[model samples]
Structure formats: structure tokens, C-alpha cells
Target chain A: MPRTVILGVIGSDAHVVGITILEQALEAAGFDVVNLGVQTSQPEFVAGAQDHGADAVLVSSLYGHAEQDTRGFHHRLTQAGLGDVTTYIGGNLAVGQDDFAETRETFREMGFDRVFDAETEPEEAIAALQQDLEIPLTETDAEEPARATL
Target chain B: MTRDKRLPESELQRIASDLRDDWPTAEAVEFTEAVEYHGTLPAEKRFAEVLETADRPLLQPRAGVPRLRDQIELLEGLRTEGGADLLPTTIDSYTRDNEYAKAQEGLEEARETGEDTLNGFPAVNHGVDGCRELIESVGAPVEVRHGTPDARLLAMITFAGGFQSFEGGPISYNIPYTKRRDLAQTIEQWQFVDRLAGLYTEFGVTINREPFGPLTGTLVPPCIAIAVMVVEGLLSATQGVKSLTLGYGQVGTLVQDVAALRALQSLGDEYLPDDVTVTTVFHEWMGGFPPDEARANGVIGLGGATAAIAKPDKVITKSPQEFRGVPTMEANAAGLRTTRQLIDMLLEQDVQIDGIDAEQEFIERSTRALLDTILERGEGDVARGTIRAFETGEFDVPFAPSESAAGQVLPARDDDGRVRILEFGDLALPDEIREIHRTKLDTRAETEGREPSFKMVADDVDAISEGRLIGRPDGSNPAPSGGDD
Candidate 1:
């Protein structure tokens, strides 16, 4: 079975392009992707994972409010029994160019398994998802896949 | 919401009253007194007249802050330092989502800490008095620019507060700006906004209603953007709005952007009632910007050059700091001046590009296809047709996050760097039009030595930001100087 992954832009940040591209990338890499779009809350993320039996949840934010928006996100996921599902956070995680190393460290401490910067392309995330999920990196299997739903 | 029918007078009043209660500051809205106050403002402060009478493409910058004093100071700097022809008071996101209490908290925090807590001015939190203060302070005409799906309360307050022009419509604001808002609900809500603006026009204030043109602000095909503009324009005219400025965003391709702008104005006039004077606004590249300031300025310069050739009525400027969230006021003014320098140098040169006519013809034909499908779906009612078309995927915006849209259609740049549809989804365009797009994209695929696929679409999305118009594969072309990492 194709591995399932849930993707979304967390909090009030309405930026969707990054996640939209990432969705296409991961789906092309053979993941059964469910994109939650933007302004997605932690509960919504948990519910989406629960509903889809997702293997991973990729959180994206571009408005510099990710740190505040994801304060209790991992705890909520753990409470919801999604602790075993992999979690990834990406995009402009902080307000300023205050070293992405620190930002990545901060989100890693918040319990994300992997973190990506704003400039990180979709391939990098796809590769990381494959590495974390142990999916074999063969030819891209996406054949003009249907638009993602839910 | 059922059909594209005008809201009755009684219904307009009922909703206006209810909207006033969304927040306490809304209590200060007095229609008759507000009309009188609008009469007191000078002609120079009128948005529609100033825009309509302009001899050249006027420059306007997007800017807003939490505090009223700081917002005023910011606008003052843009006006004096940037030489902005028009000014915008972009509303905060909480206000856009109608989260007034949160906006109030942000406003209070900004006031106390002297740091911007909100991304934009929470106009609703400021209420009528505060909006009036902003209008009175800005020397030039100010437009209330926000992406509110339900701008009913905002319209009631901002209009009564003396701002004459407002940006956004049901589809333009909802599809690109948010998720989960029903299209039918927003259409019904924006009807109230247009109806109110029409009422003001009848009272001798020509409020300029501009439909947000840059839906998704990505590689939106020209036909799709222009069709949405005409649909919104027709809807606004139905509500008695007389002065309309349809908008088009720069897509980076010189020929295509110019053609799209012209098509937007022509189609807007052809579709809407003649009594409604139609103008066009050109938004500088709304997609991702190069992280480097120098390269970002190049993007802005190309936008100005296109505006000069297209001769749009107003040009919305983008700051070089766009890649980094909200911009400082100085950077905002600097962007305006940069555009101003480019436009002044080229506006009088009469430079013309080849193939503009053919490109414009194609755009017009495609736009008509979408509009006709929409009208048919509504069964002759534009508003009803719009809602039904979106529901059925007959009309769609690419990269839309809103649940109301199918989001199935995808766009990519052709070999010539012009945006073309990569995925049709359920859009209503004719097979021949689809063939044209397919052929252009196929040409691009041949040049790139790859089959036309989603990979092209993805590459095209980040092309301009990487200092190139087309996303060629690595090793085929080296990254241009100042390309973003």
C-alpha cells in the first residue's frame, strides 16, 4: 500500500503555495497525500491523521507565526495517539533571519522529527520523507494523479 | 446567494444593522451623518475621481500597522518619500477573518509595547472614529485593501468612516485568501458591500470598488484572472456600483502581462453596464520574490515596464522585502519610488511589443468561454451562475486553498515563458482552447527535452523568484546573478 501523509499550513498563516507544491512532490514520490490546505489547527491535523491513518504529518507555515501556532501541537498529537506518526515542519519558521539552525532546533525540541527552511525545495522534503518512512526511492510513480482531497 | 439578484433595500438595512453589532466600534456608524461627512472631504481625497482622471498609471503601495498614529506616519512617509499617487490601508488578518477580539488584543499590545503585533491595521477594532482619523491624516485618496470573505461589517464601517475605494470581491478574496468559507455565503455578503457602495454613489460619492485581480498570485492563467474580474465587475454593477476598477496581476511575461491587462479592461467594459465606468489596476508580481533586494527590484522594474505599456489606471507596488513577510515603511516607499522611476522613464516612450494583438485575442476568447459557462450555470443569473460554476468545477482558480473551488486546474509557463494551463480539471474552456494551451506547453516540453507534466508546473511556480522566467532543469542553464538560495 502507498504510504499516507497529511500536509497543511498551520495556524492563521494563509500561505498555500509551498504546501501545494510539496503535496505534488510527495504524491509524485508515491505517497497517498491528504492536503488540509491553510489555517489548519492542531486538532484538525490530529483528526486528519486519525481519519486517514496517516504515516506522517507535514506542517507548513510562512507568516512567521509557526512557533506560537505550534506551541502544543505535538502534545495534542501524542494525546490523540498519533505519537508514532512522523511529523515535519517547514517554511519561514521564524520572524527574522535569526539563523535557521536555532529555529530548526526549537521545532525539533517541540517534537518534529524533521524541519525544513523556506528555501528548501520539494525534492529535499520528499527525500527526507522517504528516509524517515523507509520508502524505497525508485522512479517517481505519480501519473497525473488526481487532485488531493480532504 | 440563490441567484445573482440585487439585495432588496430592506434586506440591506437588516444585514447592515446586524453587521454593526459584530463589534462595539461598529456602533458608531451613522449612514446619513457619514454621507454628510463624505461630502465635506475634498475632491482630491475621492478615490474614483482621482484614479479615473489620472493621465498616467498611478502608483499605490500596500501598507498597514496596528496603531493609528503609526499607520498615519507610515502613509505619510509613503506619500512624501515614495510619491505614491494613491494609498492603501491593508487590514490585519484577524480582521480579515472577522476575529475582532483578537485584533483588539493585537492592537492593544502594539499600543503598549510600541511593536507591531498585527500584520495590518485592524480597521474594525479602530471603528469609525479611527478610520476617519486615518482618512483625514493621509493626504492622498486611501483605499481599504483587505482579503475579507465577508466584508459586510468592514464595508459599513470603512465607508461610513470616509474611505472611498475598497478592494476585493467574493471569489477574488475568498479563493486565494482563505479556506472553508462557502462561496455562496461570501457572494451574498459581498452583495451587501456593493449595494452599500452603490448607495453612496447615488448620494454623489463615487466609491471605487476594485475586485482583487491576483487570485492565488501564482501562475494564474490570464483568462482565469480576467474572467473572475469580469464576473466580479458584473456583480458589482448589479448592485449599482458605477465606478469599477478591474484588476490584473503581473505574470512576469512581458507580452502576456500587457495583453492580460488590456483584455481585463476591454472585457470588463464589454460585460458590465456602460453606465459603470471601467478602469484597470495592475498589481506588481504577487508571487514569491527573490530573497535578494537587488533581484526583487528587477521584478518590480519589469512590472513597471509592463504597466507603462499596458497603461493600467493604477499600479499596486510591491516592496523588495516581500519575501520576508511585512515590509518596513522605508522599504515600502523605496519600492514605490523604484517603480516610479521606471514608469516615468518609459511611460512616454511609446514602446510596443510584437504579438500583443494575437495574445490579447486569445485571452479574450478564453475569458468569454469561462464567463459564458458561468452565465449558463447560473441560468442567466451571474451570481447564481458563479456559485454553481465553482461548485461544478466549471470555473476554477489554480492553487486556490478555498474549499469552494475544485483546485484541480494547474498552470505552468510555456516555452515562451507565457503562463498556460497544465491541467484542465473540469474547467469549461472549449476543446480548441485546450488544444492551444496543450500545444504551447508541448512546445515547452520539447525545448526542455521532457514530457509536459506537473514537474513543469512546480518549476514554473518558483521560476521568477530564482531569477529566471522559466524553470529550466539544472545544468541546462546556470542560476542568474542574485538568484535566491
Candidate 2:
């Protein structure tokens, strides 16, 4: 069975293009994607994951308030019995050009499995998902080499 | 199921009173007193007059801060240093989402910390007196620019506070800016806003209503953008808004962008009521900007060049620091100056490109197809038609956040770098129009030796930021400067 992933833009941030593109990339890469669209809250993310039996939750925020928006998100996930679900967060995660390594560490401490910058290509996240989910290389994945760097 | 109809005067008043209660500042929004206040403003402070009477395309920059004093200083700097012809007070996200209490909290925090906690000026939290103070302090006319689905309260305060120009419309603001705001409700709310603008105009004060033209701010096709602008213009016209400025965002391709702007102006005039004065505002590249400031300036320069050729009534400039969330006031002013320098240099030179008329004609035809479908769906009412079209996926925006739109239409650049629809999911474009787009994409596919697919769309979305217009598989064709000739 294909891995089910819950994807959405968190908080009041309305940026949808990145996730819209990412959702297509994930689906093409052979994942059962549950796209939550934008203005998705923590409860919505958890509820979507539970309803879909998602294997992962991919959260995106481009309006630079991701930290504030995601405060206590993991706690909400754990309370909903979704603590074991693999989680990743990406996009312009902060207000300014702060050190990205520091930003990654911050989200890591908050229990995200991986953190991606705004410029991280969709292929990168897809690869990371395959690795974390233990999904071996399939024929299609081999035939079409990941064009992550283009 | 909301029909496009003008709000009754009694309903408008009752709604206005209820909206005023959204915040403590609402108590200060007295209509007649506000009309008298607008009458006191000088001619230059008026948005439509400044735009219409200008000899050249005027430059406006997006700017806003949490504090009123900071916003004044920012506008003043943009005016004096940047030579900005018009100024914008971009509202914070909280205010745009109608979370006035949160905006107020942000405002109070900024006041206490002496730091900008909010992304934009929280006009609602600032109140009528605060809005007036900013308006009085700035030399240029200020427009309230926000992505609000429900802009009733914002309009009530700003209109009374002496702002004569407003940006955003039901479709433009909702599809691009939010996920689930009901389109019909926003349309009804905006009618009240427009009726208020119309009422102000009736009192001899002409308020300019501008529909936010850059839907989704991605690779939006010119036809979709133009159709939305016309619909919003028509809706505003119905509510008695006499001064209308339809907007178009720079699509990175010079010829297509120019053609799109021309279509927007002509079609707006063609469809809107005769009493309404139609103007066009060109937005400097609304998509992703190169993180590098120098390359970013190249993008802005091309937009300036396009504006000069298209001769839009107003140009909204983008700062070099766009990759970052909000730019510093200095950077914002610099963007205005950069656009200003380019416009001044190219405005007088009669540089006309070939194929402009043909491209514009094609855009007009496509726009008419969408408009015709909308009219057909609405059963002659634009509001009803827009809602129905969107409900049925007959009308769509590419990469839209709103559930109201199908968000299925995918746009990719052709070989000549024109935006072409790669995927038309239930869009009401005629078969011939779709064929033209498919043919264009097929040409591009042949050139790339790859079938036209979602991969192309992905690369195209990131092409400009990566320093090119078309996203070739080999990445061999980097633009010599800013991805344009």
C-alpha cells in the first residue's frame, strides 16, 4: 500500500503555490496524498491525519510566522494519538534571513523529523520521505532519476 | 446563491453599523462627517486624480508598519527618496483575516516593544483618528492594500479616515489570499464597501476602486486575470463606483505582459458602465524574486520597461528585498526609484514590438470567451455567474488557495516564454483557444525533447527565481540578465 501523507499550509498564511506544487510532486512520486490546502490549523492537521490514516504530515508556511503558528503542534499531535506519524515542515519558516541551521534546529527540537528551507525542491522532500518511510526503490523511481537539482 | 445586485440603502446602513462594532474604533466612523473630511483633502492627495492627471505612468510602492508614526515615516521616505507618485498601506494578515483583537494585540506589542510585530499597518486597530493622522502626514495619496475576504470594517474606517483609493476584489483577494472564505459572502460584503465608495462619490468625493489584479501571483494566464478584473469592475460599477482601476501583474514575458495590460484596459472599458472611468495598474513581477538583490533589480527593470511600453496608468513597484517577507522602508523606496529610473528613461522612446496587436487580440478573444461563459452562467448577472462558474469549475485560478476555485488550471511558459495553459481543468475556454495553448506547449515540448507534463509546470514556477524565464531540462539557457532579452 502507498504511504498516506497529510500536507497543508499552517496558520493564517495563505501561500498555496508551494504546497500545490509539492502535492503534485508527492503524488507523482507514488504517495497517497491528502492535501489540506491553506489556512489549516493544528487540529485540522491532526484530524486529517487520523481520518486518512496518514503515515506522514507535511506542514508548510511561507508567511514567516511558522514558529508562532506551530507552537504546541506536537503536543496536539500526541494528544490525538498521532505522535508516531512522521512529520516534516518547510518553506520560509521565519521572518528574516536568520540562520537556517538554527531554524532547522528549532523545529527539530519541536519534534519535526526534518526541516526544509523555502528553496528546498520537492524532490528533496520526496527522497527524504522514501528514506524515512523505508519505501524501497521501485521501477518507476529508478527509470525516472530524481531531478531534484534542476 | 447570492445574486449580483446593489445593496439597498437601509441594508448598507445596518451592515455598516454592525461592522463598526467589530472594534472600538468603529464608533468614530460617521458617514457625513467622513464625507466632509474627504472634501477637505487637497487634489493631489486624491488617488484617482493623481493617477489620471499624471503625464507619465505613476510609481507606487507597497509599504506598511504596525505603528502609525512608522508608517508615516515610511511613506514620507518613499515619497521623498523614492519619488513615489502613490503610496499603499498594506494591512497585516490579522487585519486581513478580520482578527481585529489580534491585530490590536500586535499593535499594542509594537508600541510597547518599539518593534514591528505585525507585517503591515493594522488600520482597524489604529482607528479613524490614527488613519487620519497617517493620511495627513503623508504627502502622496494612500490606498489600503490588503488580502481581506471581508473588507467591510477596513473600508468603513479607511474611507471615513480619508483614504480615497482601495485595492482588492471578491475573487482576486479570496482565491489568492485565503483558503475557505465564501465567495458569495465576500461579494456581498464588497458591495457594501463599493456602495460606500459610490456614496462618497455622490457627495462630490470620487473614490477610486481597484480590483487586485494579480490572482494567485503565479504564472496566471492573462485571460484569467483580465476576466476577474472585468467582473470585479462590473460588480463595483453596479454599486456606483465611478472610478475604477483594473490591475495586471507582470508575467515576466515582455510582449505577453504588455499585451495583457492592453487587454485589461480595453476590456474593462468595453464591459464596465459608461460612467465609470477605467484605468490600468501594472504590478512589477509578483512571483518569486531572485534572492540576489542585483538580479532582483533586473526583474524590476523589465517590469518598468513593460510598463513604459504598455503605458499603464499606475505601476506598483516591488522592492529588491522581496525574497524576505517584508522589506525595510529604505529598500522599498529604492525599488520605487529603480522602477522610476527605468520608466523615465524609456517613457519617451517610441519602442514598439511586433506581434503586440496580435497577442492582445488573442488575449481579448480568450477573455471574451471566459466573460461570455460567466455571463451565461450568471444568467446575465455577473455575481451569480461568477459564483456558479467557480462552483462548477467553469472558472478557475491556477494554484489558488480558495476552495471556491477549481485550482486545476496549470500554466507553463511556451517556447517564446508566453504563459500557456498546460492543464485546463473545466475552464470555459473555447476548443480553439485550448488548441492554441496546447499547440504552444507542444512546440515547447518539442524544443525540450520532453512531453509537456507537471514537471514543466514545476520548473516554470521556479524559473524566474532561478534566473531564467523558461525552465529547460538541461538548464543550459541562463538569461544574460534577469532572464529577459
Candidate 3:
């Protein structure tokens, strides 16, 4: 089975750092991670996932504009032949001044598979990817052999 | 407790006394002349003396009585020398403008004679093209000026202060004999004559000239200073250039009261070019050492009430503590929130505004957070720990001896186990206790909307060892009633 990817920045209203961090983290996670960095337009994200044949497209935005920026992004992905790809997003996705629950619901309606708040740990992200991939959590052998493929 | 007001005269005397006490051997000159520009004997005599002492060889010839013609000659000579350097450097590399035109000219000549192909891989160009395409794709607001003359003349009026400050400091300081006249001429010729006027002809960037004042002394009048700043800003915007920014020190003292704000507003209204925006700097102390009642009155007593009356596009205000250097996290958080509030308020007033977040304050807070983590946990425990060693205890010292001594002692550990003392002064507490205090603050900030201050996540094992409660569940807890037996 293909490995699942989970990614996003963990902060508020500063997207530039988030984008760069996500790109580096996802590549190191042993999965084909299509990272849609900060202030990314919805269509470009969908295109990136489709082009890379990615199993998942992870979105990270730190700016409070994520609510506006990420609105309808999932639907756009599906329309762009990336419906099979799972979508993940996190960070201070909404302005801190308002109710985050309502904002989360709004994003859910727009088709996000999972939503994490600003404080979600990286380990939690890794666990989520394992669960999403249906990998056995009990596979605790001392070591696993690396698969070689051309 | 409220602090007593320090009178301006007393404050000046105190500063002078302090300087005298610090530098007993050095000769200190005291002048009581009013801060003004041009024509008066005090200013004229000072300007002549400055020119005569200039370090540049060419400027020595025309070092007295800066008439327009004399000013023109001095400027022309500098321009010719500087241009020789500028043209050559531009041809050699795309890095940035050369400080000296002669060096620039040599590089340009070398590039012309050198055999190097400009062609490169198209893919790299494609990537650049892609980035540019992305940037352009993001639609931005278009700014429309009334006309080119309005823009250009307006530029002159704006930048007059920056020009004056850039020119004034060197002369006032009496830097060196050979350089002073040349520097003054360079300021006049390059910034004023060629760049401002020539840009109008070459780029059709119009600039307006209002009646500027005569130089009375070292200090540029507030009105002219502000106008010159505006012109510099306009030129920068038009030329797509950025200048080394200058700080407005003690601007609070200059425009403290409602009367000062009103006067500034009236001057801006009367002289500011139409279609240009104006702003003012106001200093207020929210947290830190309490300002004297008079200085405090000069600040918060106005409560932006005067700002409301002035109705400038923006008003930048900072606490006294921020100016002094060591700003607390709470102060910074408050300041950031206040900036957001101010921006909102200005927007409500239908004004376009941008607030400058004190970079030093932000860096200090962020550094403190990192420092707290390092002092508690040691290196490799947190990401921000790397920058912790850079923080010097001497930074908090107001006087030279204390600062120098702190610098010497702090970088090296004491013969005893303890690190050299922290520079928090009265605020200093036990390092161990401060870490706990900072941890609580960091925890609150993390749980709240703010980002976690530390670069690395707190160690859960260590936290548990330390009796800090974490929410991880163990399977030994009682099963639910509906669980299978």
C-alpha cells in the first residue's frame, strides 16, 4: 500500500514560514507529499496533486485569510481530477477573534478530510496519516526492510 | 507611585552632566543656538567651518558661503566623481548600487572588455518567469496620482527632511575636513538636483518646490524635515529603490502636546501636495519605567485625541520601555494588539494606515522565550536555543561602564557555578525561577491563539518528571460499563 502524507504549519497569521516548512517536512515523511504552501490558490493546489500523482495534497496556511483562501478548495480538487487524493489542512486557519468551531464546520462543508488547530503536534499528524492509510498500528517489529523499486 | 516631572532644562542639564561625567578628559562643546536652517550667522558660520574642514580635496576650494551657485559647483564636482564610479559598477553586476562611483566605473569598464556570455539555461529563466507570473497574477490595488508635476513636486516636499538629516548629521558632527563639503554637495547635487530634478525630465516624475527655509543651524526644522522625507519616499517609490532607513529619535519631545500636533497638521495641510498622505509619530508608555508626569502628559494625556484632530493617514506610537531597549513579552503582546486596534481605528476613519511593529521588541520577546528554554533545558532541547547565546546582559545597561562591564562578565561564566548575571537589573530574579515564570507564560500563549514560543516541542517525559500534567492516556484506566467481559 502507498504511504499516506499529512502536513501543515502550526501557527497563526504568517503563511510564508508555513509553506517552506511543509515542503521540507512532507518530503522527509516517506510519502509522496504534494505540499500546497501558504497563500496558495485552490486551483494550483489541485493541479499540483494531480501532476505529482500524489496520494494526498496537504494545505498549510498561517494567515487568518485561510478561511477565505481555502473556501471551496476541496471541491476544486475533485473537479480537477484529484477527487481520490485526501486533503489535510491545519494552522490558525481562521481569525482568532471569532468562533473557530463554526469556521471548522465551514471548511468541513467545503470538503476537507481533516482539520487541525494551531497547536496540534507533529506526532498527531503522523498518527493521523497512519490511520488514514489503514496501516496496522501493532506492526512493531524491530525493523522493517526497505523496499527497492526502479 | 507617580514619578516627578523632570523639566526640559533640567533634563538637558542632566544629559550634559552625564556625558561630562562619562568623558571627563574629552573636550565637550556646548551650543545654545536654536534648531533651524540657513541664512542666520550661527548656521552660516557653522556651515562654513564644516565645509572648510571637509576631507574631500575638490570640496576644499569652495568651502564658504553656500550660495546657490557655490552649492551648484560643489554638487557638480561630486556628481562627476560619483558618476564615474556608478556607470562602471552597473555594467559588471546586478547586486546593488555602488557607494563610490569610481569603483563602479572600473567594474563597468571591466565588464565591457571581458568576454562573458549573458545566455543561461532557459529553464532557470522559466522558473523566474513563473515566479514573476505568480506575483503578477495576484492583483494589487492601483495607485493613481493627480499628474506627473504634482507627483514630482510633491516628492521634493516630502523627502526634504530625510535629505536634511542625511546631510545635517555629518556636517553637525564635523566628521572630517576633506569630506564635509563634498558630502554636503553630494547631498545637494545627487539627491536634490540630479535625482529629484533629473528624474522629472527623464522619467516624467514631476516634483514641486515650495519655499524652503534658510539654514539657521545644524538641526533641520520639523516642517522641512518632514517635507524632505516625503520627497525621498516619492523618489524611492518612483525609482523602485529603497534607502537605508533613518530613525526619528525623540520625536515625541518635538510633537508632544495637542498644540504641536495641531501645528504639524496645519503645516501639513498648507504645504503638503494634494493627493499625498501624511502621518505623525507619537510616543506613549504603556508598560516599562513610568515616564515623568510631564513626559507622560506629553504622551498618553493626549490619548490620540490630538491625532483624531490631525486626521493623518497613520500615527506611530511606542512605549518608553521599547525606546530604552528591553521590552517585555507582555508589553510586546500589548503593543501588537494595540497596533491592530489602531489600524482598525484608522480604517474606521476611512484612512489607509500601516503600523510599524517595533522589530527590536518582537526580536527581544522571541529571544527571551528562546533564552528561557535554553537556560532551563540546555542546548539541543529547543530550536530557538541557537540564538540564545547572542543575547547580551549589557544590552539592559543605560550607562557605558555598566554596559561594558556587563558585556565582559556575562559572556564568560563566573568562577562559581552560576552564569554571569542576567542584565534584567531590578527585574532580574533567580534564573531557575525566571524559567518557571517564562514557562507559564509560554504555556498560556501556546494554549491561547498565539504560536508556541519555543522552536522545539516541550519534552513530555521531562514535563511528567517535573510533575506537569499531560493528557496522554494509559490503558490501565477502568473500562466502560458496556465493554465486553
Per-candidate chain B TM: 0.98, 0.98, 0.25
Off-target runs (Cα >4 Å) in candidate 2 are A64-85, A93-114, A132-150, B477-485
True contacts kept of each: 0.39, 0.48, 0.00
* Worst lDDT 10-window in candidate 3 chain B: B84-93
lDDT measured at residue B265 in model 3 versus the true structure, 0 to 100: 37
**Best TM-score among the predictions, by candidate number:** 1
List, residue by residue over B1-485, the lDDT tens digit for candidate 3: 10111123354345435433322221222221111111121322222232223232111010111122222232233224321100000011111111123333343443565522221111111122221232122221001111111121122322221111111221111111111122222222223322433233233222222111111111112222232233333332232222211111122221222233333334443433444333333223222222222232224323344344333322333322342333332333333334334434543464322211222222223334433443343233221221122133311211111111121111001111111121233222345644643454445434433322221112211121122222122222322332111
Candidate 3 Cα errors over 4 Å, as ranges: A1-14, A136-150, B1-157, B160-485
lDDT of 3: 0.31
RMSD to the hidden true structure, all candidates: 2.7, 3.3, 24.4
Q: Which residue pairs collide in model 2, if any?
A: B378-B385
- TM-score for each model: 0.94, 0.93, 0.31
What is the fraction of true interface contacts found in candidate 1?
Answer: 0.39
For candidate 1, list the clashing residue pairs, or say none.
B378-B385
Report lDDT (CA) for all predictions: 0.90, 0.90, 0.31
**What range of 10 consecutive residues in model 1 chain B has the weakest lDDT sum?**
B475-484
Ranking by DockQ: 2, 1, 3
